[model samples]
Target: MHVFYTPDLGDNEFYSLNEEESKHCAKVLRLSIGDKIQLIDGRGGFFEAEIISAGKRRVDLKILSRQLAYKKQYHFIHIGIAPTKNIDRLSWFLEKCTEIGIDEISTFICDRSERKILKEERLDKIITAAVKQSLKAYHPQLNNAVRYKDFIQQDFTKYNGNLFIAHCEQDSQKLFLGDLAQPNQSYLVLIGPEGDFSSEEITLAKSYGFKPITLGESRLRTETAGVAACFELNYINR
Candidate 1:
């Protein structure tokens, strides 16, 4: 069955697809009336429905059955990193993380950040597509870009002692994230920009109880670091 994202599908017995979705469902997929398809609300709502009316402009479906919290991850993974100069790199990072199972994402402007602004709407669309591609029921929350200093100051009560920052700086004191972090807990992993974080930024993060972690021996780009950290955590939790 074809899968479609319908984030706002409330408890209505019948649902009409949006214009873009309608065209894709009817014209592109050529799904006709009585065809069955799957819908996800991106909040852990998975639904099965049969098309009642199929048209290029509109596709109406009658809800058949629904399940909540479908294939939900027990652990939460939130990665905060600096945006890449090329937005596509960030898009790549988002897509990979969403498939690997992330809970939330935030972009923070570091002292050495090359790109400070982000196309959040575009990134959101990429994430949505990734979720549907991976058949995920929960949509990852994407936060707007925030300055590094301000972001580090916010109270992460949910993550608690799981705060960590990954940097390119070669420090023997830095511990492997895999060894330091415990499993099945919420995480807040921060990755820096192309030039990595300034000494001052690292100091400030440590002041807020953010432990310094190493992704690996080799130096990595901003987006690569983000993906590495995401994979590292997910691998550990596995």
Candidate 2:
């Protein structure tokens, strides 16, 4: 079944698909009235609906049934990474991570970060498409870009989860990400930029109780490292 995203879907019996979604459904997909389709509200609500009016600019769907999907109890994964120089790499990471499973994403600019700005609107669209393509009921929260120092200063206690920063710097007590992430627990992992975090930044993170960890022996790119950390956390929790 083809799935469409409708973040504002609520208790309404009839919902109108937005202009973009309507074009995809009525023109691009050639869907007609009476065709059944799935809709996700991005808040865990999934609806099975039949098209009532296949208008090119405003398709209408009548809800037939609704189901709520919930995430794993006590397991939430949040990844914070420096945006890569190539925006495409970051897009790939967002798509793959959402497909696998990610609760939240935070992009921060580090001292060594090559890219200082991101297209938030485009990134949000990518994430929304990923959610629909992957059949995920919940949409991962994308946080606004901020500086590394300002990001670290946020209230970590609210997460009530373990925090880790992955870096290549030689740490005497560095542990593998897979071994460090505990099951049925929340996690927040930080991935540095292509040039990696500065020594002082790493120290600052350590001072804030962010455990210095290693992804593996092989050094990965910024986006690759973010996806790797996300996968490890999700894998261990599962």
Candidate 3:
């Protein structure tokens, strides 16, 4: 069954699909009236519906049933990374991470960041497509890009979980993120740019209570490191 993204789906008996989704259903899939389809509200709501009408611009469906999907047993995963020098790399990371499972993503501009500006609108589309393709019931939050200092200074008093920063700087006491992160605890990990974080930036993060951590022995690019941290968190919970 083809699943569609309909975040605003509520108590209504019938729901209309957006233009992009409608075209995919009517023209590409050739779905007709009375065909069964699945809908996700991106907040854990799932619905089984039958197409009442199929048109290129709009598709109406009569919902047959609604159910809430299983929520993540572990705490939410929040990854903050510097935008990659190449935009495609960051987009790829977003897709793969969404497929695996991520609660939130934040991009920060670091001192060594090669790319400061980001196209969040395009990134949001990539995340939406990934969620649909992976059959996720919830959509991950994508935060707007901000400077590193501003990001760290924001109030995180409500967050009662692990805070970590992954950097290339040599620190003999640094431990693997998998070892430091406990199960069923919220996590916020930071990954630096290709040029890595400046010494002063790392110092500032440490002062803010961000524990220094290591992804692995081998160094990785900004996007790779972000995905690696995300996968490690998921693996630990599983």
lDDT of 3 by residue, 80-102 (tens): 99999899999999999999999
Could you give candidate 2's per-residue lDDT for residues 68-147 as a string of tens digits? 87443458889999999999999999999999999899999999999999988899999999999988899999999999
lDDT of candidate 3 vs native?
A: 0.90
User: Model 1: per-residue lDDT, tens digit, 1-238?
Assistant: 9999998898989999999999999999999999999999999999999999998999999999999989867678999989888888899999999988899999989887878777799899999999999999999999999999999999998886999999877766699899988888999999888888999998899999899999788888888888888888889888
- Model 2 clash pairs are none
Among these predictions, the greatest TM-score belongs to 2
lDDT of 1 at 136: 93
RMSD of 2: 1.1
Instruction: Itemize residue pairs with steric clashes in candidate 1.
Output: none
Q: Tell me each candidate's TM-score.
A: 0.96, 0.97, 0.96
Q: Each candidate's lDDT (Cα)?
A: 0.91, 0.91, 0.90
Check candidate 3 and list the clashing pairs.
none
